[model samples]
Target: MRSIVLLASACVVTTSSSVAAAQNPAAIEHHLRYAVRVDGQPDVAMDLLERMRSYHVPGVSIAVIDHDRVVFAKGYGVAAFGGSKSVDSTTLFLAGSISKPVFASGFLRLAEERKISLDADINTLLKSWHLPESKFTEREKVTPRRLLTHSAGLTVWGFPGYALDSAVPSVPQLLDGTPPANTAAVRNDTFPGARWLYSGGGITILQLATTDITGEDFPTLMRRLVLQPAGMMRSTYENPLPMSRRGEAASGHEQIDTPVPGGFHVYPEMAAAGLWTTPSDLARWAIALAHSYRGERGGVLSPAMARQMVSKQMHQQPPYGEGYWGLGVAVIGDGDSLSFSHGGRDEGFVADFFMRPASGRGLVIMMNGVAGGLMGEIERAFAEEYGFGAPPRMTRTIVAKSASELGAYVGRYVGAAGKDTVRFDVSVAPDSKTLQVYNSAGRR
Candidate 1:
């Protein structure tokens, strides 16, 4: 594969065959300064673009690294869902838990600087509040590492904010499991690190720890420790401040025919979840990670710290490969090809970051839809085009106990999710190897 390095004022970038196909050399070269390295089959990315039109993803941007350079970087869909505004590589979106790895890096930096201790019990840092006296275990022993790996046994998902009808809990009250414990956010049933539960609260606790350390506000500390150090110029921990402050951010949209309003979620717990960044800015951080791993100097973080940041801390993530959760990131795949990847889903947006450190490959994809949106599709297309894995299994097969046993499973039913009921239908097949599931409003 022939690759050309395009130079601009700020940086050098690479473009793959797909990007070169639709745009002229100058246009492709323009993006080379900041984003996109198209190295794979451009023809495959083009096919995926056709399929994305029906999903209402509106806008999409991809950055792929080929060898030492980013060879494929380009935009696929419209920048905004409402009009014909085309998206570019610089488009920004909410990073969701993708913020975790980034935030965890700050903590690791602090640890490396001898300012914080990862093995110390988090209770030592949390000055004011304390966990309840549980019969299961001593909560005082929970450390920062557990919270980082989600071994802290927080909730499976996140806590839904206090609705209009419900009152929100104070941070101390949230940890104590007082009023408005919606089961997603706070629960007395599980002790810290007893099992694997995905809790934003763990990150919130991390937020307070930083607050305690710096005594400055959360946003200010994060700006200093993370945003500034990582060279995430277009990123901020101060989310949803104003469009003026965050120049040229892409507009968020929901899964609707007409434009849906209020594309933002006011995340009180900003450290674990809240981050808005452009793909171009994020590429800086991605490249810094690669450099750190390769023992390059003047990167965002030190080489030793970077290695610790990606180390597999937990094995409980079964059915997903001794699946390892690092400080705040999930490390996937076997040795030599390990990946640090994370995905985020908010009300009106979904974002994903894929980085293969060994090969120096990274990708960022964002869409203005809810869950079940663009990342999976784009990944599938990438895999198919690159021969990483076979095309996704077209047929899904399931083995059920029996027809009579399936009777109990069939129902015009509602999921026992939470306060609200999600209606769906589940019918059993006597032939087995399949279960008919009616598409529900919940899934949509």
Candidate 2:
């Protein structure tokens, strides 16, 4: 890793044109043949590269953590659609909402040092710009704990970000939803601590609070208290990355065919959707938290604080069915079965990372494409290959049928009732044992 100076974009160490054999040869072989079962078929395994091509995902970076170590880290595809620069372990990608968890870590470190309190009324700790008084705040105090848990009832689910040459608002301006800011002001609509509502606005408030209490900017405080201590040296909260380091950052793309005109969008909401980082750097942050949870301090968070950080802070379950928000990360299951995870999307970028704190096994994935659905499929492949848990349950079962039976279903079925024309193709797969249904993308 190279020392990056404080500039618009932090300069990262440039490496060779390529990376080591896609991280590991054996793993790649396994992944290619055992990719997640698409549709209802069991033997349908699409290689990662093939999936990228089909989904129009241009670049991806992945790192696997097992037994307290980053066992593998690699990149795939070109950083830009028409360019040859390969995405390697150090290539930067937007952390998106993953910044929330990282930001929570930094805020908790402040709490650990007695610089801030988790349960303190957030408005009392602010001076530069206070959270506007609302009927909601009068009923229940909006504390750091509630804010971290996203129960602060703040508005703005997320930020869309600005183009590289577009106007970028300051944190205060963003909070107030003032001129040039696209979203509404960050204020509570419901009672505090009522339920879970994903609010990037709330996280931005914490960023402001941290800045006010420490008399330091968000990025500087994050560096001193979180990134430096956790050894995430390659990551930064800086937005509109400095010009010098832009070459090392992966270019964001709409899909495989369309890259953003400026390579990537500039996010002014640094706390909620900023943080430029790599998968390897994020794995280090996850591993550090895992280590801390085991009573071994690996970074800024204390053992007790780390446990509470990932513990069940709010009981409101996410609509996804199996997860609930912790202080920052989403915890799946309960007790020893708990695993912490979070997913992020910003413009043309998508990312996700997870870890089983007790077992110290996890993976981090980042891609510079809008094909976020590809991330979940890739995760399914990795999970199955690594034996982290059972393979994803198939939605429907595949039953064998004779040639005559299969032929009966093969044909173009046209809808007669709809004003708009609708058609579907149902055909038997080459193997004869399964059927292939052409989806909206026309892929079987």
Candidate 3:
């Protein structure tokens, strides 16, 4: 909403402050209650917030829209690690795989124009390329729809990317399981139109196909079809820090030994892993999703296609159902009150988007700087708050070890003094076992 630039430390602290400021009525503190119907709302909302915060998500940006209105939008924690910048509605964040469903929406738009066919195997559209050979399966039938829905079964989470000074694979090399891929070839992992598997590589191939077929760069395509139409102005498909434009984005951090700025280095794959923007901007995208479900022309996608996008594509795991996979969005359920969502995470970033078509409620959360996998709990909280489903029960496993073994978990936290860290050391004697926490700041 505003043209603003910030340094790392200040960016992290202040961004969240603006979103959670006292003036904001729909702050993240009560995000769980935004459109959720529960027996006791206020108390439950407070507890959910506590649990989310308790999980060590340093920063979180959440947006809740109901019935075409923005019911809640708030930011939490620091956007830039060791910086004063806070999470706010205006802060830009990497939305990881969330961009996939959005990209799928673009493909659906082209399909509507009869420019492409979802059922058509993608081999025909590769500009100067074709699917690589696979000893495991036939590749001729691999379709764009299957790739978008992850049914085409391409392997690899992504390129795994080479850094600024490192050698990265070219598009074909990456797809062909060449030197950089170092794994399965670009050939179909599963027969086309079969089961679902989450493959960032599949999306990457689709990018090549989409660009070749449409004659546009990925950025131009996304902006023209999805960003502008959906009103996501503050976003872009550009992933790495644009040369000469480095300061425009919020930096990320990691907390393994100490809080380090720009966590895990930069990743090179922009299509499957790039795209950055604010929750406020994404909120509009969520609203567009809400509109699409309600028979409104929210943007690039038709209403029918929009519904198809969020439906389950494949059964990813047991108890998760044969999750609907239309286009890119992984639809988890079709309950009268809720539809499941797909979330994305990268080295230094994490994001989640939930659309409740049944109730006209949509939510998205983004965060920079992570402690560990605990960041996912917030998404679970959002679902539970809305009565979408019950949170899974976790069982902790305790192991015994020697004192020397337990002593290895020691570390000093270089972050702000108050931030707690999680570290455990294990040690034991032949007669019995012992556990010692050399350094642990955060409460578990």
Candidate 4:
């Protein structure tokens, strides 16, 4: 399994581009009104509404921040298909893994206040369910710092969440992977601090530790330490979001354009994937981070801590070769061009945010359907409008090649690394100048 995973890892490179400063609302709106285009395909352009319709996304909300302030925020489409409620700046959508960075900010505040130490063994702070003792902990103990950076060597990359009507697991039950909990037990598989691997299970441990330390529920603690301070009034870590806010919440839609059972799955893994927020609220949180990074007062995190939050903690290994992991976000670029970002995907929601703290610029995008590709198109539109350079353009430059030149590359190739072997065949196209590659399945 490991070798197969390694072979698959060698097959792709992930690239992420940053967004620039914001412009006037009218100009930005005008830019969005025009057709969004793919980087290399000039003919693939669709107007924003048309694109949304084609992608089956029922609703989308966007917020742009420039010079440390939200310059534009709006929503398009209905909160749920066939519903009369329209999405607006205040409409809430599940934030999925974006919850990590937000939760990290609150967790750091605990560290700042001297309530918890980032480097202390997590067992010392956790009173609810202890991280089970294992061989992986012999030398390096799992600590808050390691968990924040996803270097704790823990298992469970993410959760599938519970159906709205299903029984929800307690934090301890979830961690132990007992009945009612849908994931495997959260335990160490590799030596802690050896490498970077994303583990939402690790963040769940933090959630338990935080609640145990503060003697407060996760939602309350986050509101007091992070959301309220950061002016994210519309955000909440509550699972099965309260009924009072239901009218303002967008129903999650599957990729097929149908709403999820009972509107959406309920995520009890609140610290990792259960946040509900508006793009505007997320923008506010991003702005607060920028302020703290600049050493300004009245921010949730201290300037020093905020700096570390966005600094590179560890380089991500292959398959995630695009960037480094900060405390809770992905760090890309460097120095003046540096940016911190995170993307999230739940059962029926997709959200993403990018912020260039050095320049006080960023954008938050939230949608109610599983339209991952559409999110990229929207992001590129924002990039072009705000002048954040487009993602590396993929251009196909045709060069005249002799038949012999193409023939030289036409052959069957087999490569083995350890016990795993990869086999593929290459053949020239009918045009003779083009090449086609096929795997063992004979499909290109």
Question: Which candidate has the top score in TM-score?
Answer: 4
Task: Tell me the deviation in Å of residue 368 in model 2.
Answer: 0.7
Model 2 vs truth, CA RMSD: 9.9
For 330-444, candidate 1 gives per-residue lDDT tens digits of 7666555666766665546677776666666666666655534345555544543333311232332334476677776766754433122345667775466446765353332
Per-residue error for 239 in candidate 4, Å, reads 1.1
Residue-level lDDT of model 4, residues 1-444, one tens digit each, is: 112322222111123353344356434433432223334545443466777886778999889888888988999998898888999999999999899999999999988886677889999998867998888898899999999998999989888899988999998999999998999999999998998878999999999988898899899999999999999988899888998887879999874557887888999999999999999999999989988998987577889899999999887766534358889988877776778888887988988888888778888889997765567666666666665623643545456788889988888788653123566788899887789876553435
Q: Report the error of model 2 at residue 189, Å.
A: 0.8
User: How does candidate 3 fare on TM-score?
Assistant: 0.73
Comparing 1 and 4 on TM-score, the stronger one: 4
Sort by lDDT, top down from the best: 4, 2, 3, 1
lDDT of 2 by residue, 22-60 (tens): 344236423643323345556665678887877777888
Candidate 1, lDDT over the whole model: 0.59
Reference-based TM-score of each model: 0.73, 0.82, 0.73, 0.84
In model 1, where do residues sit more than 4 Å from their true spots? 1-46, 128-133, 137-140, 161-188, 258-260, 318-322, 371-373, 385-444
lDDT of 3: 0.59
Q: Tens-digit lDDT track for model 3 on 50-152?
A: 6445544556777866655677777777656556777677777777777777777777877787667777867777885787656534544777878887777
The CA lDDT of each predicted structure is 0.59, 0.76, 0.59, 0.81
- Of the two candidates 1 and 2, the one with more favorable lDDT, higher being better, is 2
Residue 208 in candidate 1, Cα distance off native in Å = 1.2
